[model samples]
Target chain A: MIDKINKISDVEWELKEGFMPNMSVPARIYISELLAQTLEEGAATQLANVATLPGILKYSLAMPDVHWGYGFPIGGVAGFDADTGIISPGGVGFDINCGVRLITTPVKASSNEMPKIKRLITELFHTVPTGVGTHAEKKLNEKELDDIMNEGAGWMVNNGYGNPHDLIRCEDNGCMKGADTAFVSKKAIARGIPQCGTLGSGNHFLEVQKTAEIMDEEAAAKFGVEKDNLCIMIHCGSRGLGHQVCTDHLKEIEAATKKYGINIPDNQLACAPIKSDEGKAYFGAMAACANYAWANRQMITHMVREVFCKIYGTEYDELKLVYDVCHNVAKFEEYEIDGRRKKVCVHRKGATRSFGPNSPDLPGDLVSVGQPVLIPGSMGTPSYLLKGTAAAMEKTFGSTCHGSGRVFSRTKAKEGMSGQEIKEDLEKRGIFVKATSNKVIAEEAPDAYKSSSEVVRVVHDAGISLKVARFEPLGVIKG
Target chain B: MSFEELDHTADYLFRCRGRSPEELFSESARAMFSIMFENNDANNVGNNGTDNGTDSGSNNCSNNGSNADSDAVRVKKEIEVESDSLSNLLIDFLSELLFVAEVDCLVLSGVKPKITGNSLKAEVFGEPFVPEKHGGGTEIKGISRSGVEIEEISEDDGIYYQAEIIFDV
Candidate 1:
């Protein structure tokens, strides 16, 4: 796979038309030499396979953190023409809008605060519902579920889970337009209802941290982040509901693929024209799931605040959302393709939007500094806070790397180490961890993933986003 | 029927083989269950660390034979699902199994599957996934169509069916 593609620039590699017979356009991957060394042949082949999709704009692009996913690479980003192009569920991963939200607190770090941080993480573990087959304290009826799918963070705020300003800090005001409850399957609804306000197992986590260093003082101030300031990061998405939606829609689109006579290399890459009934229906369901994810994260944020309040008697409002970004999602946006601007459907799986300065998607305070890009590192590592750059807007469809992509398989990671040992190691580093099970701790050990700083540097050096500050975990609550 | 782990850059990959197609599917389900819970069968009573080939950390919490506890090993569960083809039949079967694991906290065991027309009927014997009674490993989020392969291959044991599946762990 590495031999099939050639380096086009210092950070970009090209897979020409001849690389795949059915490819509709050339493919490009943005990675440094070290990343390319570990890039799997199957992953590169998957990226090339995405190029075969009809109406794919520019190049089927993969970010520095790219890895083999279902149909597209995990960090893959692609845009399709709105009128003639197709929409594929494979382009958007199963965890619809599995995203991250960063919140800043007035609390500061100190030697005496270590016990408090440990106590806070322990409290968070019990406060937030987690693990497989887990249910939230609140169960919703059909109407309430619909309200959540429709109103998203707005509903949460109005219902008293969050403040109104939290909406502006979210993408699309925390509710993507065009969500239709009717498009959501009954099974999806059944799965989603009980799983709301949860941080599902497998890599989802809530972390308490402090800014360790500042890379850009002005940019960090604009985002309300500085050294020694306490912060929280929540990583989760539309739990069972989104998984069911993807399963249902993937089957639907597979049938539609045959009906539409669109040939694809993989079954998971099933799709239909954007205007087609199947395509429109999938989009509607996906949007609802995305909204559900935002609401889920918001609820988790509310729970996090409750933990802080119980621990320190601080007001919930004292913790403010810096930004919430959807890593796996598809949105209709206007981008300049070639010389003319066109409206297209952009699909980002395991990737985050890094909209540059002056972009309307940013909040008022962040508009001048570019959108806040939150990148969570692996367990017991330093996560970076970055700002979107104009170069990102010009090159990556306003997208950047999401997280440190995994290097070791879950099974491999678990086989090599004991969860108890991992927890002990993390605690030794002054990072307390509370998890549903030790196996998760072992599976998510820092060594199981690539260096997040390296992945960030690839994108930052490539000029997609620039580092603003660094956050080191003080405590973590893992599901 | 037997299963073994295959190395993937990310997620869990399993290779299962059996004398026939039905056996293959059942073994596949067992492989998936073992990945979730070290004790795929109640009779084994959490035969922990050795089951995963490598140490699965199951000695941490094996089992006690008692019916009164919610953690008591379950007897059995019957499941039935249909799809257009065998590949989808496998996906549907595993998906329903995952649903039970996520929503019901059942650890599947004694999987028996039969193909009828385009659909599949399966019976799963499982126990409540008691953290106090069972060793918990990686939680599988979902099964994927990516890199899924079902083939008939011959070995010294005679003609057997084999499957390669990837899970979103």
Candidate 2:
């Protein structure tokens, strides 16, 4: 059922509407021929389904790392009319605002520091709560949670979890407005109360890496990444809070579908008109989840810095945040659709916003370059630090691929290998690994995902985004 | 029919041969829901309570024997689903069933799902159950379209139907 695609370029393909009924737009895939052939027929079929969604502007787009996912494909990018489109929980995914943040340190990656690197990772794993249902040692009262919902990472900085300057580099300054905590359910709030600083599980990790290469010297310098400098990247999201929020809103939107007479090809794509009560509620709740996620990662930054202090005997001033970017989020931003600037709610699931040079939203220091786009690779792979490009804004709605998207299923990875085997392999390669469960380790083996280098290559070569620096892993921690 | 664990997650899949697509979908839903509760007996409740807070109503059907009805009495209603891909179609189908179950407390009795190109058409049956009165079965947690599959291959027994699904704790 997947043989109908016609190649458009070395890294692009088109799944004609004849491949699926009711498809409003042709599905466009950005992938190598090898990866495209390996793709499950289901992925293409799903992309076609996404095309049928109401208010889907342009083509239903998929990145090179495209994979099958609920509602929209994991690497899918689509925009709906802010006034007429509908929002689906599956589009933003259960891991609301799941993203990556990079922090550069003066420490260099070296053999002499290998042991300390392992110790740092160990300390991080010990300090950060992980796995399913794992909660943090600290709890947030109702007032505090509300404040966090409103302030996001800024609240964490106010509480001394991170430096104030850190927000300058974070997307949306780590806080999205119109986050109504009242829209967030009590169950979600309860789940988030003690999970603000936890890492959670399933492809989430904290890695200590070194800047291995600089693709754009000027851009790299602006982002504060230097060759051989040690950097820390944390990947996580709102955890159970986000999941519950999606669940709560999915039902609400499902009901709204009936009320608004919105016909969705898939129930997972259940949505309400953007101006409806359901849409407003979901937008507010989703923003709240985004804030919760930012605050969650911000708290994790505190834990990472604390662990670093214990391992290097240095102070927090020694390590600095490069930037934080959320991949799974929907935002209302003004962009030119044809020739006119339209305010659209851009839903980027498994995609990151890449606003190019002179973007007013970017910090002044980075205005001449672009927003720092943190694209993390799979464990043991090279993660890239890219800068947004003008082409991104003009072509792909100011977005780029998120990471080395999963190629193989976790079961497939675990069936042929063991976590212990993966750990040993990484250790032999000079990369230290620590995790709460071996099962998780196996599931997240680098082999389970596409090479981030290749994903970055597509974006860079496509001129949608510009590469800055590459970070090679030295040590890692996974939940 | 084949069944495999979906990756390392708590999701599972069961592929079964059926005479029709709706039958395949029915078995798939049953197999997926079986993960949440013990489906071995019609009158046994191990530890999880049988009362699932919400009303089971007259339209609800449990997997147990008390709610069992003859195939003749099982009414088949046409079902159609639209999605971006086969995997999502399966997920949306299951999610729709879950939503119906939650709102109406009806357990789908049988499903004969047919995939004609990208559009899915199925015949689903809804029946009522008295779990507490029947002294069997537990409340369903939640349903998810996790590991889903649709294959055209037919076994000697019948047509093959399979997919993976998750149930909330």
Candidate 3:
């Protein structure tokens, strides 16, 4: 049951304390009435549960793309007191630090590039491993795994996987601290060892797109995304390693829940006080997973560049990383609460941080234009690259929606569509697609999700995150 | 019980129907776990004990006893899973059951599961007290409803449940 909701504006709704039992503060949702009504009852109910978490301050928030997830609803945002709040694996999701990275190419959008696009996608599918239990061609030994976990994308840059400039454009510079490899379990290490650079199945993809619209001139200039410019977007994460970490921590946190005398509505919400031993262990393990994901993306970026070099006979420098952002993560960031500046652990399960311009965290070159926000739409639809705004900081805790939220379940998606049929449809529309499995294609079909353009419209109008450019898909390679 | 094989895109579909969802969950668990090992002989490990050496089967049962319900005579669970492929669907369903046993302190028994393809139907009998007739070692968490759903195929109007579950890591 929920109550005390107040309409703050046309697009923003507030959930006051009396709305739920044990709630510590109010909650804010950035969405229009049309989008709100489409939300599943489970999403709102679970969001209420998130607000009850300990050490919560300001609000438990949901982006317009909010959908039901494990514990915290996907697209949900909540910040907890670093010293007193709890850390839950459910908040980070199974694919730790799963995110999107965009790279602009020298190529342009045109029907003439169809054959070349097909060749590039085929090369990518051959180079990148996909599906369940898929192992990479290059396996990591124990010491190498530890190094990759510690150094993150920096390790890749040092090892010739990517350039140093790529890291500068990534969120958190492509690494987070406190990832102690010692906290990771033997099973986790084993599962991750052979899967360092593989793209695991389900929703993960590598797509070639071309900018179709430029909405913000200033931000687009900073991001190097202009109309008709070709770009590559890689969507993946730590793979088996991240899944194992969540599995290992869920058991540990369940025990810690009893030890700490913490009460939660769902066992999936297992957690411990942030400063406690269990919490520290999970955080360390989670960081390692995050690093692994960054390294994986870096390796894939190298592959994408290789494909482009082979197709266009151009140098690697021709393709550059515009920005990479992690959507599923927990970060210790500084935010003002009660007029006091404090460190808070911000958990964004399926949400992205949309820090406004001039924030200290932005790269020096991007400081004047705000952080670049990458919102990948469903397969075959248009994806957006947005810029953060000052309004986002005041309204959505400097956060915005990640992508087109799921409207139909995977089962429903598969039932109504066939992968072959979907592939043919996209092909007819001049989009090339290479997938590891037909089932994955069906489950991620464009119709099974909300329109990304509509979702972006709500956020842009709401002033949470403003649109910079929209890219239409030209080709996609899915795992 | 009735069983049907429906197409689930890349994987074949298996659907089972019982009088109740409890029967569906139990039968589904058994059918799914059977894929992990070569045989369905539950008693083969009875005298052999756990080969993992982490804990004896009896000790595990004892540890689980404290968490059993005191007043309730029994609880029952039903499970289903949908995945893009057969292998992932199997792992997801079994892992989910393992999570429930380890975290929620629920002991599952009388599992009679049936798997047709990607669709798994199982019924599980859960009770607060450890069943004296059977020894315990494995547990199942509730299936994740995140992407779990039933879809109707227009080709034949066949209904299949697609779902996944997380187990104790």
What candidate 2 gets wrong by more than 4 Å, as runs, is A1-3, B1-169
Model 3 global lDDT (CA atoms, 0 to 1): 0.73
- lDDT of candidate 2 over B48-94, digit per residue (tens): 33432211211122333553232312334566788766666666676
Q: Whole-model Cα lDDT per candidate?
A: 0.83, 0.73, 0.73
Q: Give me the runs in candidate 3 sitting further than 4 Å from their true place.
A: A1-6, B1-93, B96-169
The DockQ leader among the candidates is 1
lDDT of 1 by residue, A1-479 (tens): 46667887778888887687788888888888888878888788888898889889888889888888888889999989999999999899889999999999887788678889978887787778766546776777889999999988888999999999899889888999999779898878888887789887778888998999999999988888868988999999999899989888888998999999999998878999999999999999999999999999999899899889889788999998988999999999888878998988999989999999998678788889999898999989888889998888888789999999888787678787798888888888899987766777888989988889899988888889999999999998776
Query: lDDT (0-100) at residue A55 of candidate 2?
Result: 80
How high is the DockQ of candidate 3? 0.04
Q: Give the native contact fraction of candidate 3.
A: 0.01
Models, CA RMSD each: 3.5, 10.7, 12.7
> What lDDT tens digits, residue by residue, belong to model 3 across residues A236-323?
8887678767866876787898899998877667789999999999999999999999999998898779878988787898898999
Per-candidate DockQ versus the true complex? 0.30, 0.06, 0.04
The alpha-carbon deviation from the true structure for residue A354 of candidate 3, after best TM-score superposition, in angstroms, is 1.1
Error of 3 at A213 (Å): 1.0
| DockQ, structure candidate 2 | 0.06
By DockQ, highest first, what's the ranking? 1, 2, 3
lDDT of 2 by residue, A154-228 (tens): 999999888888888789999998898888987677666767887765678889998988878888887888899
Q: What is the lDDT of residue A124 in candidate 2?
A: 74
Preferred candidate (DockQ higher): 1 or 3: 1
